[model samples]
Target: MTTHPAPAATEIAESTSDASLARTRRRSAEIEEQIAADPGRFRVLTGDRPTGNLHLGHYFGSLLNRVRLQRAGVETFVLIADYQVITDRDGVGPIRDRVLSLLADYLAVGIDPDAATIFTHSAVPALNQLMLPFLSLVTDAELRRNPTVKSELDATGERPMSGLMLTYPVHQSADILFCKANLVPVGKDQLPHLEQARVVARRFDERYGRPEGTDAPVFPQPEALLSDAASVLGTDGQKMSKSRGNTIELGMDADTTARVLKRAVTDADRHITYDPAARPEVSNLVLLTALASGRDPEAVAAEIGDGGGAALKRAATEAVNEMLAPIRARRAELAADPGYLLRVLRDGNARANAIAEATLGEVREAMHMAY
Candidate 1:
């Protein structure tokens, strides 16, 4: 029987050449090696949207890595992507409180504000201005072809896509390039956004930069620094997400954390094992326990052998609460001093504005727009 070709498959395969995740992974390893050898040579940019409280998934996924990089002597720039909250959501939802809460979370997790530049998106006007020139470097077709953008749009359902949503990747380029950050920490899903940033940097240098080989490029084509942490699953065996009600938020108290872990889904199998493929729910619990307790997952499962789900839940709850205790205590202390948090943001904003203005000036000179 005659049949039409699969358009979706074709698009994905064609897109894979430009955004090959495998290629990024190889490059990530090389970047990691170089960073290890000479950490001072790199500047990293990473951030989060202030949509809600940071969670355990975020802790293992990105926060811990940020601290590691900072301690390794790499310069870190942490952005509170306050503006991105509206990319898909309808309202900002107490954004001010959320930003403060996020700052507290970062501090409690060992993100020393003294060492890292922590700023909000709205605070840096020049950074946002870079979006105009960066947007011109890319095409509408390229933006629409972005798998991440398409997936996000699909998630928004029938809501009409906003101009901001359509140009999310471009804005992200501005985020990376405005600070002239040479490295970015990202998960696989975000590689596409990072790739778009690299493309913008290259195009801008080619079209408006100093004569070929006469001067350094206007911006560095930032490289991806992928995390080696295992994927963290929610208690329900699904991706840990706030909207899914599965996340163990960093703001949760010990008692609340225990209560949440207690109801986590586990299989009927009386024997506990760490086979993620065969028993995702039970394995997820064991994984959480292992991560928190700093033990291997298999060992954690062996310790709970024949104890069934009860033993697993108890182990996870205790381990998690113990690990989070100091963080929670520090968070409590920080919460009591709102003035300190404001000062941190204000200082970071001032520093960020200075950097963005400097970069924008370079861009203007490169394009002959400087008067």
Candidate 2:
């Protein structure tokens, strides 16, 4: 009889990490192929934090994808990540109002409540319960290595790091898994978070899933649905963010939109061009115009050749205002009726709670805690 030596801890860890990466890559490719073949066949989970009103960046980046996916008959769940707001902010005093505002914004932007399931994070207690088991599946080193966490910490400068902030990626896994979501639309920068969720799903399934021959897993590994939308820049030409105060809110009135655009930074060049690197500020406006007017960026530039920064800004402003008119009107209508908005959220929460409870039952059973 021959005896095989057990692998060292470091070797075991390395092997596990490599396997996780392989699974993620394979799953990602499968999802892409699946989407191409039949987009309506998969469940999608995507959402936003209720830190503030959404902007053009949110519109182009993820909301647009949500609308399209829902319309295409994909089962979509839009989460109001209220718990995540405290991950960075010092207080939750404003979160309630922000959550309501976010819901209104969702409605204003054409997300039909009847078509997609929209729910608040706090409304579903099962998701938070799942976080405990999920936290154990991920490692401290892995959480610390998350680029999103690192960037956020670095950006905070001297702010104290909270345990919640470090484990946010794990919480995200709970969010994704609770819905059994197979597809999560995210930007390139968010790939790491999605990858972590996939890792957690695979780990849980391997540990507590059905017998080997059955191959039944309670959670389905989610894959990232990377968006191809052009990056939306802020008024200062940086990434559009509410914190930076450079974002053009989706609900901004036509006059406010135009005023914000007028203050947008641009170069001294008299000619309009589409050189993002050399002229990011000007190029940003051109791209915005293209997105709003449904015209090519180069074509927009050609239409305004030698028109100077003033002319380019004016044209972009006009295009943006025109695009925002209907959205603003809809937002106003939604915001005026607080009772209706509350009812929408209440109904969504009930639906989400039922689904979450069912998932939690399975999770508990798999972990031998059913008694």
> Which prediction has the highest TM-score against the true structure?
1
Q: What lDDT, from 0 to 1, does candidate 2 have?
A: 0.83
Model 1, global lDDT = 0.88
In model 2, what lDDT does residue 116 have?
82
Clashing pairs in 2: none
How would you encode candidate 1's per-residue C-alpha lDDT over 266-366 as one tens digit per residue?
98887889999999889999998999999999999988899999888999999999999999999999989999999999999999999999898888888
Residue-level error in angstroms, candidate 2, position 327:
1.2
- Candidate 1 lDDT trough over 10 residues, lowest sum: 1-10
- In candidate 1, position 226 carries an lDDT of 73
User: What is residue 360's positional error in candidate 2, in angstroms?
Assistant: 0.6
TM-score, per-candidate, Cα-based: 0.93, 0.90
Candidate 2's C-alpha runs over 4 A off are 1-33, 155-160, 211-215
Over 46-99, each residue of candidate 2 has an lDDT whose tens digit, in order, gives 888888889999888888778877777788899999999888777886877888
User: Candidate 1: where are CA atoms >4 Å away?
Assistant: 1-19, 156-159, 211-214
